[model samples]
Target: MDVLVVGDANPDLVLRGDVRPRFGQAEQLLTGADLVLGGSAAITAAGCARLGLDTLLLTALGDDVFGVITRQRLEERGVTLLLQPSGDVPTGLSVILTPPGDDRAILTLPGTIPALRPEDVTDAHLSAARHVHVASLYLQPRLAAGLAGVFARARALGVGTSLDTNWDPTEKWESITDILAYTDVFLPNANELRAVTGSTDVDRAAASLVATGTTVVMKNGAAGARAWWPGGECSAPGRPVDVVDTTGAGDSFNAGFLAGRLAGLPIPEAIGWAATAGSLSTRASGGTAAQATRAELA
Candidate 1:
């Protein structure tokens, strides 16, 4: 496997078109809705597989209808699954409401997500893949608890590592400070960078993270992304595309950038690829459907 992705696995129940809630006894209609395979890690693995990498997805699922759908989609995308079904807990789920301007409000149910253990993420898995990507750090409590040890083990095995510590539900934004030092590729949105570093300024926040020897890629959606190293930084302008849905676009961007780096592309070219990959993914409602392959990227 070229990349090993570790995180939650779930199906996204997406509701599009001005969605709103009604009172206790009332119900509203939605213009569109679909059940699709989604999760930051799953999307990244699908993106990498589509871009021609041998991708391995390490996560847990449940023996349910949603899990079946998730597994099918991942397999169709050529991702080798190292997933197990838990009899006790149901699979995770996300209910997304996408309104105008590609904005989304998400309600996530963490079922089997918190059950993922660092022990399952074996050192052999780390040795096989050239790179390992961990997503949605804050969602999985068990995984996040041992992330530093897992990441440290990956590094000790000479495997490259990346982390997309998605929104912290608890709002505490803890544990990332130590793990950042073990991360080779750290992807965070502008807001996350600020929240994690407790800085009102982007430059200062990025610097705080960069000083840990991790290359920080700050995602700014419409403004594209910026990458900062020890003493240098570069920005990639956003790709102009008709936005359909922004869900998982950042995960797709991480996939593109990591793919570029693994392929030995220059930083500028890699960020360009990431911007394009992310923008193009918005052409469809879900994350994986519109992802471009390596041939398409060319």
Candidate 2:
């Protein structure tokens, strides 16, 4: 199936330090540092392409150095690009500091990523894909608000929809209803589910999100993922692999799960593919590192 990934594309600068520093203090540095193409959609699209899918990235990139590097990285991975070029501002960039086994803090500049609009995605592009996955909704207000119309148009053309929401407690979730109503699949991590639904229990959170008019898949990190609908619940365990970095695991999981589902696999099997892909992604540095191929996933 052809997959169209619509969302953020940012260059990720990773710094490994021994201990996370306090607000005013400096940190002890560790060795392994590298740059990679990140942002939820970019990573997921690259993962999908690596897993042998026909993938296209519908995103905005600045006419700058970071954008050049980001585009080069995506092209190197064989993911097709549908770029909307921006000349006024630089491309989005994220500074990620991974201090051993924990969640990393991200400092990002929206740059060109938040500038994507419905008009930016042409009908020819939208109609060409079987599935359109748009991610990081909270990070881009205009695109997030405009997604309902895009989904409506895609639905008219018989294309399925998926959303990988990033956490933004600031936006009113009420505004997301229309877009969610048209979504075929909703993919969010456990924390994101809570942020979107204001619930703590995994089942309750998933239920609340699914009630918003789409099937829910809650990515529960090390515990695996929970896929649910009105009357059914399916869980997949995380694969045990030696860890290096947890940067792009969730995005890779989204890629694997969607790839499996598009191939007509059962929900349980899809989650298994997702979990393994997510786990294997951490074996190397950076978000796109160590992403598995279709053969490896099989």
Candidate 3:
């Protein structure tokens, strides 16, 4: 595999329209509701596979209907699955309430997402990939604990690693700071970057992370994405497309950038590819639905 994506494997129960739930025995209606393959790592893995990378996804799911659907979706996108299917628990699930634009509210049930341990990244997992990516850190307790060893082992084998710290439900962003030392590429959207750093200035927040010797891919919705490293910075304007849902835009960007890097594209050019991939992802109701392939990019 060209890259291995480690983290949650789940399905999204997405509803489109004004999805705010009211209290006092009120009922709401939505124009559309669909169950689709989801989870940050799964989406990115699928995106990479669709873009022609030999991608492997290491995640945990339950031996249930959702898990079956998840496996089918991943395979349909040509991703190699190394999933841990648990008979003891159910698959993770996220409810996405999209309000006619990019803005969305998500409710997640952790389930088996927190069951992946560090031991999951063995010699077989690390040796088969040139790059390894992990997402949804704050939600995966077991995976989070073993993350350091995973990165270190992958590094010792000359493999690069990236991390996408999706929203922290607890609002405490301290757990991820220590792991940046092992991360080669850190992909975080502008809001997450700001909140993680507790900085009002996004650029300053990015600088603080870059100071740790990690390349930061700062994703700014519509404005595009910027890559900052030691003494160098590159930015690209996001491609404009018909808006649908923005669920996996950031994960798609991560896949695009990593695919570019693995294919030896220059960093600036890769950021442009990432921006384009991210923009294209919003054209569908689900996160991976409109993911672009390498041909679409041209």
Candidate 4:
């Protein structure tokens, strides 16, 4: 395997246009609604597979309709699934409300999202892959608690590890330093970088993290992405595109960067690939709907 992705895998029910909720039994009309594959890990895996990487997604899912849909969508994208059964609990689900020209609000039921444990990622799994990427760290508490050890083990086997901790609802950015000690790459958005490092200045936050020997990749939305390492840094401007939905653009960017690194591209060129992939993903409604292929990224 070229990459092993560990994290959440579920279906996202996306509703667009005038999505703000009203109280007192008020009913609102929506412009569109569609159920599609989501979860940071799943989207990143799909993006890697679309980029021609041999990707394997290790996640927990229930035997439910949503689980079935998630499986089908991932398989269609050529991602190999390593299923972890979530006994009794239904699969996790997220309802994304995308208001016109505004940021989206997500309501999530973390049914199986937090089910994955450190033991689930066996030594065999780590040794088989050239790289391992973990996503949605806040959503998977059990795995997050022990991810440092997992990454350390991967590093011992000469495998690279990266992490993208999606938003933390608790607002407590804990245990990140330990994880970063073993992480080769750390991906985060501007807001998350500040939150994790407790520094409002992006440069300071990224530099602090880079001091620990891990590459810090900050996603700057329209401004594009920037990366900082011990002795160097690079950046790429975002590609211009008509964005339909910004659901999984960041995750796609993570995939592109990792894919480029695995393929021996330099940090600056990889940032270009990351920006292009992220911009192209927003061309459709869902996260994976308009994800770029290898040719498209080229």
Candidate 3: lDDT of 109? 85
lDDT of each: 0.87, 0.86, 0.88, 0.93
Q: What lDDT does candidate 3 reach at residue 225?
A: 93
Candidate 1 residue lDDT tens string, 1-298: 7999998779999998768666796876778998887999999999999898899999999888888888999999999999855777888999999776545789988887877787889999999999999998888877888898999999999999999999898989877877887999888998888888999999999888888898888888888889898778999988888777888899889888988988999777788788878878888888888887776566
Please provide, for model 4 over 126-156, each residue's C-alpha lDDT reduced to its tens digit, 9 standing for 90 to 100.
Answer: 9989999999999988898899999999999
Which residue pairs in candidate 3 collide? none
> Which regions of candidate 3 deviate over 4 angstroms?
23-27
How good is model 3 by TM-score?
Answer: 0.95
Clashes of each: 0, 0, 0, 0
TM values, all candidates: 0.96, 0.94, 0.95, 0.98
Model 1 scores a TM of: 0.96
- The deviation in Å at residue 230 for candidate 1 is 2.4
- Give the deviation of candidate 2 from the true structure as CA RMSD: 2.0
- Model 4 sits at a Cα RMSD from the real structure of 0.9
Q: How accurate is candidate 1 locally (lDDT)?
A: 0.87
Question: Could you give the candidate ranking by lDDT, starting with the highest?
Answer: 4, 3, 1, 2
Residue 99 of model 2, lDDT score? 76
